[model samples]
Target: MAGERVSLDDALSNVDVLDDLPLSDQQPMVEAQSCSVVYTANFDTNFEDRNAYVTGIAKYMEEAATHAELNKLLEEGEQHAVMLYTWRCCSRAIPQPKSNEQPNRVEIYEKTVKVLSEEVKKLTKFMKFQHKAIEVFCNQVKRLCHQEKRKDFVSEAYLLTLGKFINMFAVLDELKNMKSSVKNDYSTYRRAAQFLKVLSDTQSLQESQNLSMFLATQNKVRDSLKEKLQTIGAHEELLCEVVNISVHMFENKMYLTPKEKQMLVKVMGFGLFLIDSDGCNINKLDQKKKIRIDKIDKIFKNLEVVPLFGDMQIAPFNYIKRSKNFDAKLWPLCSASTISPQASLMCHLPRIREEHIKYISDLARYSNEVITTYKETARTDAENRDISDLAQRGLMLLSDWTSVVTEVYSWKLLHPTDHHANKTCPIDAEEYERATRYNYSPDEKFGLIEVIAMIKGLQVLMARMEIVFLDSIRKNIYQELQDFVQLTLRDPLRKAVKNKKELLRSILVSVRETSADWIKGYEPSEDPALKGKKDPDQGGFEIKVRRRNVGSEELELSLYVPPGPSSTQLYMVRTMLESLISDKSGGKKTLRKEMDGQHLVLIDEFHKTSFIWSYLLNFSGRHAPCPCNFPNWHGHVRRTTCLYPNRHGHVRRTTCDVPRACTLTGTGMCDVPRTCTLTGTGMCDVPRTCTLTGMGTCDVPRTCTLTGTGMCDVPVPVP
Candidate 1:
């Protein structure tokens, strides 16, 4: 019995020594004694359902010291363990023919035996390597327990190494099942072959020589591998002891409370379980499980749990921190952790505003460049690709800018009260206005107002870009370019222009109303009865002005007066519109040419409104009233006459067609004679124009004009 292996039945009969031991000790002894039964258990049983047999054994080896030589041995041991497990898996995948069934050809049996021989040779080498590796690993574990520093022993790296050891058991178990399958298949084939008498004496001799030798070698390798795995299982208690000692060491060093130490152990155990159960590559794991592993990994790496080792306490918004020297220019590029202080955001409003302005300006310029290069021309494949890339970059930049602005806005919202005084929270518009007025002196509320307007305009542009990209799939680059110019560029510019017009009108009315008291002082003395009465002129002027101003300001400041916030906003709006329109590539001219009749009318109206605003702002009795002139679509100068109330308060309206050479006199009268040209039937033959007239009437005969008596008229045939 010296060289004989102990059978499972014989081992069971010899369990008397475990009988006197405690139940806990008896249990592991019984499991170890029944290792063969566990190894041959049905595959349906969970592999991870093992008891703490190893942990119990590892307890007694906690004080063993490791030698320097064991380090190299342990490393080589882990490598061999991995190779051995891989070979065992490969060996299991080799097909075994059924022994009870006769093969259609003798070639099948010969091939199976040949493959078995080759595998046996390879497995023998791996088994030798693994045998040495296991010895070294066990010795290392013993020495590791006696070492003072056990922190590295409990690291993820070493835990992974231990996981390879546990995997060896599963490999051996699977190999046993595979061996059983091979035996059953071969037995069936042998019986059928013998019954059929399918081989000659010489063939039978050759088959026995090759097949029997291979079977013997395979059984030897498998037995050796199983014994090696059992050796590891026998040291399971020592491994657990090492882990326990290391955890205690870590607990003291980390200053963890008893509960915290327990939590750490539990987390470490979970991580080790995952490493043991699943292979090393976490990317191949199920999504939810992978996410859990990642979170736990962060917890371990950063030690982000409560009661950290030092005096560091978690900040309220610790997820994002602001740097002391936060730069607004670099804000868009800064990491989330360095760009979130409310005070920093408030302090950098001006620079941030400038950055946004510059971005919009650049986007506009780039858009024009895109149009000039790609529009109205056929493009090669490379050109088209380039265009697409540029467009995508523009969209990406826009998205980043929008996100940064939104984040800044969110921070503002979170800390709505001003930090200086800690006042009650204000609405977004009010807060923006107050910040602007305080930070940007002289310009008052306009600085922030312009920024908000630009943000809105950019938002509109972003929306248009989205549409352009979506449509670009079905449409050519040219069509998309046209769409960009029309919707993204021109549309926002039109809105800004309209807004400026309204703002200008409001400022003019406000200034007039505020200076009404001054106007009243210049008026002649009224009779005692009419002293308390309101002036008819005042009512008319106020009514006419009120009809012109439209829309409410988003931020209404009490201190907002003429030429302050309103004028600044108007100037800003005008500047942005001009920058977009002044493309060096003649895109502005091209845009005008492609515009529809409505857009042309808007341009005309804008110019006319600008003229009226300028005239009113500089109006004085010393200067004579002159007609406002602006170029028409044909590049011809068209004059519009202005009429002022005379001393007697008389006013008149008239129609006239003055030549280009005509001029208006100091009395608000046209100095040139008006000529009418008519085709045969005497119709006016031209579109009639309207002009304001003074108190006097034209004495020239057959000329249409306004008079105090009535209106001058020339009869003509109806169309």
Candidate 2:
């Protein structure tokens, strides 16, 4: 028995332990096992009784064991023992069969052992590969962390190393879950094998005992793999340290350059993509899983990470073309040709530059500070220092800068501009002076500081105008004056004026032009005849009439007339009278009338002794009133000179009664009858008579009827 026990030990010792094999080999091994079972079950047995059948099986087994083709099975020592034990169990499990029956229990049991061995081999291979891969990843992370220099922070090697580390986290997680599944499957296989061993006969039981010991060895190997995975997982602290160091380098604004910051942002974006690929939320992760960098965490929360394809495995270094959340201004630090396919994709995302991020941040800070300073200045009624310290640090978007200008303009409009006043505006003279003292680029300095200065200076001028002019006069021209000052004067001067002296000189020039008599005495015409003319007295007191050639069939007279006498007209008449009176020599009173379709009649000279009048009239009586109300009796006429005729056939002229006031207080020389020739009432009133050479006579009575053309026309009275 002791010799038999020793022989059994030797057999168990020679049994090859299940080892790792490639996954491709597993299916073929399973198929081979199935074929072996089928061939063994179908083996011919020409015996009449159970003993003969048993004897026949023994002879077949003995011959099969010694066969040269089965030499490999003999070399598989413990495998033979397992096969023998399985055959014994199969013999007891199966009932006695008829002569024609084919027994398959032994074949099935032998196939079971082969399948179990294959599973063990696969599980072992998986565990070993995972363990080695994890160790390599951890060591590589350490090497990369050590090799990284401040200058090489944005280098491709460093960034790719970081990406590998991120990938390691996912691999480690998969390893743990795989380990659990292997353990469960092994437990089930071991339970079934133990049950079969218990039911075996004495010699078969002895042979099957080693199977339990082999399974124990497999359990020990699995346990060791588990311990190793745990050891690798414990290195999370090392990963945390690397991440923290990187974040610290990024946050070190005083030392790192803009290029480095931009690269760091890209690296963080890549890490975020890896995390998202694993179905984990950075912000909402558990404490153990969190990256633990406050700034990085904040950035992750603030910026969105949208993947082009949901299952994409690559990073976005060269793949992404645009991304608002990630800074890519200094991206492709390495050559684009050097980028590997595994690291990039052909996709687009919104992006911004690191410089732009800083600019926006600084702009937001400056805007808040300026607004606060404005509130303080308003509350304290004291001059405050300039709040433009952050303005020189970076450049901002033009749209954002325009908003600041608009805010400052609004504040100036609401509050008083005077620094000495009890209720003052946000920006005062002292603040403006200090703000302007600093040298700034065109974007910030001109866009914000100088723009605010122009607004403040213009506000002061407007306040002075408010004090000097009447409320009614200001009401008519205040809005137009503001727009004119901004567009024509303030904007041009802002570009040209450099120094305070220049600015003040420009402001003085603006004051002179804005405070002229024409601007200050401006009023909206109440006369219906001057409604459509846009600022007729804006530049000078001159009437402009444009003539266009028209077809005879569509011919119509175009007449422009003022509703009532205006200061502009009075000014023109005054200049004419002055020119006439300035000549001391007596002149002849000549009457000359031009009868062309376009030219106006001219009376060369008029003396008090004798009056001579020349009149020319052109008319076309066709078409209805124009949509612009031009043909209505009470409608306004644009760009036309007015001449009034009295009952005695003498032209009436107006004189400026108020001298330089130039108000519409002048009176006409004649007391013309206010009666319309067409309606014989006061519907359209004017005093003139015109004759169209070929068509008919058009009479302009005190109140005349409207014609197809805007001119006053009436049928000639039969004499």
Candidate 3:
């Protein structure tokens, strides 16, 4: 997963920042991530003004071509479909109520129906507009293609006709998705609310028996929707299949294949005659007397499953990126048979191609640089910075080209909805001042072509930066982890030796499996060395075993006596002096201490015979951080001095001011300095907290848990 390309899902997951957010914040976090710039890129509907208008036109025309001379008929179809769906769903949610169920189920259902119907009316208006636009666009194409050179114009005319179907496919797909997914459309709130009302308290709801009945009701209402959807899905699938064929024909040199080459030659010649020229060859009129522009629609209707477009051999794409242009040579299958007046406009079509490409690329580059500057503050480490700016800056188009892109994509431009009344850019109010300085004028920076370029640039930049960020992050993580591995790996014999008595007083070890001699060392309570004497006689000695490290093994010597601080030195002393044995069987370790709250712990169990220089002097030369995080952990392991003068002078030796304190571990007890007001207790792990004095020993479990809700969710013992 770390090595694989970051998908939209992964990027969004990180935006949610799963680990940092509380469970309660999960839903909102997900919503926020979806609302972020990355998610907005996936939503193609948010087009600029010019593009949206164009797309709107394209959409309505396609809907028109589907019907004959219908103004509101297609829209009515959309309304009927949505209304039936809404009513059925609400009606099912409130089953007959059995005469004893919820009192106002019917009233609630009826109100829901009314609300849903009201919403459908508004939604249908967009659909109706979309239908009209589609029809108008087709009509425009029909008029544009009436050509004197019909054969030459056929390809250009066919491309636009082809786009009509593509646009329809895109619009309808978006509509279907919004209708089904609640995550996409918040307008589905009513239906979601009804669902929640019935399935409320999912964790402990009492309607377990009625679950199946509820499901059945949902199925009953959704059955019609499902059928309508399946039909649409089939059509979309076919539409996509056709679009893929068109794209291949347009892009990959449609005449490369011998058969396709023959088709293009014939189509061009036939198109020229059908436009405005009188027919020279009678053979061109095979199916009809005249090759007509409207006949192009018939080709789509009965498109043969000829293996010409699909499932054919193709050239490798390796050099395609470096190639100068998209091989635009193509056989216009739509115009393969006919030409008309509409085909005549190809000669008039402006050669604004390069201008459009440049506009898109330039806008993409600038946007990426902007997003990059914003992100750099968050990416603090210079070592972490690399070739992760946005994607390849897209080409810059002219204002006109930008407008075209926006219009074609059906996105709203950065302009007011009523562009005719007020020629103003509808930039976010907060950024208006900055935008003006950035050369984004209030009026001129819009329309179909320009808006399209901006959107195209935005999408390219969004995907590009995301790719770059993830790629750089992957490399950074790999290097850091490798360096960590290299640190210990450089030395074959050296291993990390952590002293436990200084940290928590308990030890752990991992060693290799093949070594005969145990290489075990412990922190000296006093002496610097003696290779950490292992006296077999002293019961401190336990079994020896082998452990593994970096695939190598060394014998590990562990002293494990039965549970009772068998892990501590006190247990060893008890084992030696059988006479002092008292059954405090399995009692939790407690560190009882008293202090004026000024003295610090040095070390315990100093094996040195010298008392004065045993601990304090040993650590005198070490560096102490200005604000040492570990107050209890003295810097050095050899020396420990807890000056509890009130008790005994020996340190690491438990001293109890409570009359009788065991001189275990041969260490000093708690120190009572100049003031006799301080009471001193022995040091241990689970020592009870003193309520009156507010002081405790720093042994056993060392962490101080903060009380109350804001603290970590570390589980507490029930007792």
Top candidate when judged by lDDT against the true structure: 1
- Cα lDDT of model 2 by residue, 1-719, tens digit: 55655567676656643334346431211010011221111111211122322212232223222232222322332232222222111122212223334576444444444445555554444444435544554454444334232111122123334443343333233233323434443544444455445336776455334433433343333233324433342233333434554555555431112223333444454344333212233343324555643466443322222121111112223222322233333233322334222111111001212434454554455445544654311211011111111221211122222223332322232222343432222343333222222212234323343333322332232223221122212222222233332323332233233333342233323332332234224422341212222333656333221111112432341121111112222222222222223221122321111111111111112111011000000000000011111111111222222334555556555321111110122221111222344445432233324443333323333222333343322323322
lDDT of 3 by residue, 239-312 (tens): 22233344444334332122232233222222222221122222233234333323333333122111111111
lDDT for 549 (candidate 3): 18
Clash number for every model?
15, 16, 95
Q: Once model 2 is optimally superposed onto the true structure by TM-score, how far is the C-alpha of residue 152 displaced, in angstroms? A: 10
Candidate 1 structure quality by residue, lDDT tens digits, 1-719:
79999989889878966776666321111011111221211211111212212221121112111222333454554453443333312222324344646564456555435444444444444445545655655555544444342322232224334433433332332343334433443443444345445444986657644544443354343344334434332233334433333354343333112222323433343223322211232222324342233333333323222211111112211211222222233222222333334223345456656766666775576466645665433233344334444444433333333323333333333333443443332333344323322222323223333433444555455434433332232123223222322222333333434445443233222322222222234322342111323335543212111101122441242122222112222222222222222221122242333434465465444423332222122222101111110011111122333232333445434443332332222222222223333222211213222222322332222333333233334322222
**Pairwise lDDT winner, candidates 1 and 3:** 1
What lDDT would candidate 2 get against the real structure? Answer: 0.30
The all-Cα superposition gives candidate 3 an RMSD in Å to the true structure of: 41.4
Off by over 4 Å in 1: 1-107, 143-241, 245-719
lDDT of 1 at 510: 30
The candidate, 1 or 3, that scores higher on TM-score is 3
Error of 3 at 601 (Å): 87
